[model samples]
Target chain A: MCQLLGMNANKPASLHFSLAGFMCRGGRTGEHSDGWGAAYFEGHACHLLVESRPSANSPLARWLHEQPLRSRNIIAHVRKATRGAVALENCHPFVRELWGRQWAFAHNGHLKDFDLPLRGRFTPVGSTDSEHAFCYLLEALFRRFGHTPPPTPALFEALAGLACEISGFGSFNFLLSNGDGLFAHCSTQLHTLQRRYPFARARRIDDGVTIDLGRHNHLDDRMVLAATAPLTEDEDWTALRPGELKYFRGGQDLPDGVPVAAPLLLAV
Target chain B: MCQLLGMNANKPASLHFSLAGFMCRGGRTGEHSDGWGAAYFEGHACHLLVESRPSANSPLARWLHEQPLRSRNIIAHVRKATRGAVALENCHPFVRELWGRQWAFAHNGHLKDFDLPLRGRFTPVGSTDSEHAFCYLLEALFRRFGHTPPPTPALFEALAGLACEISGFGSFNFLLSNGDGLFAHCSTQLHTLQRRYPFARARRIDDGVTIDLGRHNHLDDRMVLAATAPLTEDEDWTALRPGELKYFRGGQDLPDGVPVAAPLLLAV
Candidate 1:
């Protein structure tokens, strides 16, 4: 499978520092370098870039590190294909339009016997379980909500339910967004961390570089990072409880009617 | 990088049908076909499997369609190399031990200048940015909180701050878990969907097959699906806002102090 990385903040910020080290996983220190891509949200709109090449070698991924594309949310991916051909079309994170908004997604697993019928409203431009699932999700969203977007609470509720049904087919771990906030689900593995004031200098496990976020954002800025694993070497990343779910935004977890277990502490 | 697929629910469910359609994108219909892997969470543990081949052509992906791996949470991925040579050692959803919990992660983007040093507490066996990030994150968490766990609210706050700092380097979108509810982030692109009672039959966009989730889930059961895109033809899928982050557990968004913008309704 591939890897996932995300960030949600209370205010507009740049992921350049974190991304500097994170991108190295594509071809430098790691080996998932099939392709690389990323998105930057500015208000209600998003800017996206993708390359069907390794991040370490891809000039685009390199530029991304240097460019200070500011946004409150961001999604990026590096591929090691298992479901589709190694082409630009199959590279993630995949994007589409729904409820009049551009939605992006990326997957980290495979499902069999999953030849879904595309009803046309949302079609798969690429042939990958990740893309298929993305199109299917959009189709379902259009059919149910049409052009009118649902309230956040209600929409999150419905999405949670749908995620459960689809995950039943196989290991379904995913990251989703629409330039608003991120939604995540895990079947086998997933981890998360939030950063805010009183920030500390942290080191990258992929690279020995360290950064002090405290030097960047105001005390009010808060951010969240959910990944298949932790990204820093001096911060606390929590593991999701099995069969659990929650929602987050503006660097804070939203309150909902779901029951969640207390987080388990991992012994380092 | 690889793709990720995830499902969360209130009850045990199988991803046979949905995963089957998604697998097509791995090689037959999509381009991620370097390799495929998936894991189904059963209680606190997970059932894992992988194949260093196209999911569409891989017998393992096909067998998964017929084999009913039941779980409330699932994680899946299809590789499209960006780093190490195509091999199982480079495959994702990468798992590790933290605080006695198995943590997993999948990445979809690349990092730059990600050369980092480690304390050897957690070493990445694979040469992927995803793994390096994971090991770094775990090491950081252990360094910060040690064997004791912090409160969820505090933990989220710290993680979010760190994520933002790291994201500054490059695109970082990801899904993470420890056999529990999932944590996802969006640096550029990613989307999510939630489903619950009053569910109905839905079609897929890739293979044109349909499944009535209503037949599988109880009226009261809630499920969440997070992906690079939507999965159904008749539902609402929300996009993660740029620079946005979130957490999911149960069937609702967790309440946090951070500000969360409504779903983007920008014209397509």
Candidate 2:
């Protein structure tokens, strides 16, 4: 198993604080040392950084320590190489273009026998079940909606249905973003926390470091963070229910009231 | 106009030597201060680093100077923002996946009214004539030859014919790679140089620094470099012909004997 981290903020926010603790899990605090990757959405573009080396010891990771890439949405993952070779192509988050926007996806858990029909519209560059599932998900969406998406709620409903069908295969915790906001699904382990006007001091779960969020955040700086495991110990982190889909935009949760489509028998 | 630099090597080689000088053109040596980007191919994966800020002054560029990401094929570009906005989306080399392989592309010149209708399979994330042209090129090829490409020579022929058509719109000098090798099409300004067994001392044209390449490379190490301008003053850089398409693999040319298909009236 791997790990996933996501951030959605009303105002563009820096992720160094959370990323510091999160990267430690790549090698220092945990054994997920196969690789590490991240994607930060800035305007219509997603800047992706993926390394096959362990993040805790990578030079790029060190530079990221100093430079704060402010963004409204971000997704990150540390890999343990459950279903693919330990290579850069297998590193998440994987970026693809759909509807003229760069979409990035990252998976934390395995999907057994996820051999989906690609149909040539989308294909996996890496030999990972996660990438294969991702491509399949995109192909399904494109087939249904063509280029532009349907109304927001309709699209959400379709994604939830797709998630439900895939989760049946195995643990399916994943994070996705298309420069607008973040979409996350949990089949096994996931946690989420909100940071807002009333901030609190937090302790890093990995390194035991502490910081006062109140000093670093503005009054309007509302944000949501979701991860496979909570990065901080002091903050209140909510455990996402199994087989749940979550949507976040501009720091607030978009309630998952959209009903999943009739159980999909669509399997490869 | 922008600037392009590409490397195809027999052995996986470090790019610091060429990149150190190439990056200077983003602000120091030349005036391409709009943006800059680079792509390094590792096996079937391409690690891309792009920034909206000038490469000569970007924090990421400074960090890259200290680390060596060696690869067999590489492409870099420094933009002067002739058409699109100065943003991350407009930064090249732009990457898209086809046939489950990541293809990276970058251009050095502008095209007037280079609007091409996209058929939805591929689209540009940015509003640049360069990217639009790129998407059109890919669409044409995919339309003719689905996901899997024809033979190598046949693919090269199609690409050369496409290049001839697009170059009619502007000075379309570009470098494209799909991890295996590099394809270069030069309309106005481009140069090529080969570094092999009898390497000699070289001085950087941008930074005025000198290095003895003979000492740094192995006896069998071979590389071919293509750029919009000669990076070093001492090297024997050959200026590409007014209209030329060159293919390079493992540091050697594949000899352009492939015949171009007759021009078609497929204007978008």
Candidate 3:
């Protein structure tokens, strides 16, 4: 299994603190060391960096940690290479253009016997089940809402149905973002944490480093983070139940009040 | 107008020396100070870096100059913001996926009245005539070839016809690469140089920095470089004619021997 990390912020925020602890899972504290990738979204543009080297030792990853490249949405992955070769193309998080915006996806769990027929609308350059699933999800969205993206509630519902259907193959824990919103689905394991105005001090779970979140954040700052495992020891990290899908936008989870029907083509 | 630089090598060779001179044009030596981008292709994977900052003074561009990341195909651009805002999304060397391969394109000139109808296949994420032209080119290719990519000679012919058709709108000098080959189309200004055995010393035209190519390259190494202007002072750079299209694979230009007709949809 790979490890995934995602962040959504009301304002452009840096992932420096979270990445310090999360990247340790790539080699230092965990076994997910095959490859690593990170995508930072600034408006409709995404700055993506991926490497076949271990994140713990990669110079580029270290550079990323040092540079405070702020973004509204970010997704990262540390791969263990369960489904694909340990090459640069197979590194997550994978990026593609959809609906005139750059979309990024990263998977934490493996999928078994996933033989969904691709309609050539979105094709995977890598031979990973994760990429195949991402392509399928994007293709479904494109087919349903050709060119015009649906509203947030409808998109969330469509993604939820698609995630449920894909989870039937095997484990499908994944995080996806298209700059405007972040959607995380849990098939087996996923955790989420929200940071608001009244922030507190926290300690890194991987290392013993401690930090005061209040010092780095403003009064209006709000952010949501999702990872395969909790990165901080003191922060309140909520574990999502299996087969649950969570939607976050502007640094807060949307209240589960919007009603929408299942997707039209879940039978596929 | 912006500046474009591309390199196609028989081996994965570093662009350190060429970039040193090319980046100087971003701000220090020339007037293209809006933004800059570079795409380095390693196999089917592309490591893309773009910043809404001048390449001459940007920290990321400086780091790129310091690092010797080698690639068989590389494309770089320094933007002057002829038709778009100075944002990350509007930076040159725009990338998209086509035929299970990442395709990168960088344009140096501006287009006038380019209002082509998009087919919702490959949409431009940024508001730039260059990106619009790139999307149109890719959409045309996809419409012609469907899921399978055509042979090099056939692709070259298609691209040549498309280049000619697009140039009818305005100046359309560009560099395009899909890892396997580099295609250069010259509407007004473009130069090409090839370095092979018997390498000699060269001086940067921008900053007068000197380097002995023989010291860093093997005898069997070969590379073809395309730029808006000759990067080196002592190299025999040939100026391409207007409306000329050149294709380079494995560091050498494909001789004009493959007989192929113009694309059928050039009338469109």
Q: Score the docking of each candidate (DockQ).
A: 0.01, 0.67, 0.63
State which candidate, 2 or 3, has the greater DockQ. 2
Instruction: List model 3 lDDT by residue over A120-152, tens digit each.
Output: 988888899999999999999988888898988
Question: Model 2: which residue pairs collide?
Answer: none
Model 1 stretches astray by more than 4 angstroms: A257-268, B1-268
Ranking by TM-score: 3, 2, 1
Best by DockQ: 2
Worst 10 residues of 3 chain A by lDDT: A254-263
Output the better candidate (1/2) by TM-score: 2
Query: Candidate 1 residues B1-268, lDDT tens each?
Result: 5567777666777766667767777877778888777766644444455556788887456555765456777878888887766765567676554553455677777777676666655666557777677677767777788766566666666567656766776777777766666767777777788788888778886788888889987888887777776666777878888666666667545554233456899897
Best-first order by DockQ = 2, 3, 1
lDDT of 2 by residue, B54-110 (tens): 999999888877876789999999999989899999999999988888999999998
- Each candidate: what lDDT? 0.70, 0.90, 0.91
List, residue by residue over A94-207, the lDDT tens digit for candidate 1. Answer: 755454355778777777767767664444555678777777776676667765777777777777776676777776677788777877777667788888888978888888
Q: How far out, in Å, is residue B191 in model 1? A: 40
- The global Cα lDDT (0 to 1) of model 2 is 0.90
B68-105, model 3: which lDDT tens digit per residue? 69999999999998887899899989999998899999
Residue pairs in collision within model 3? none
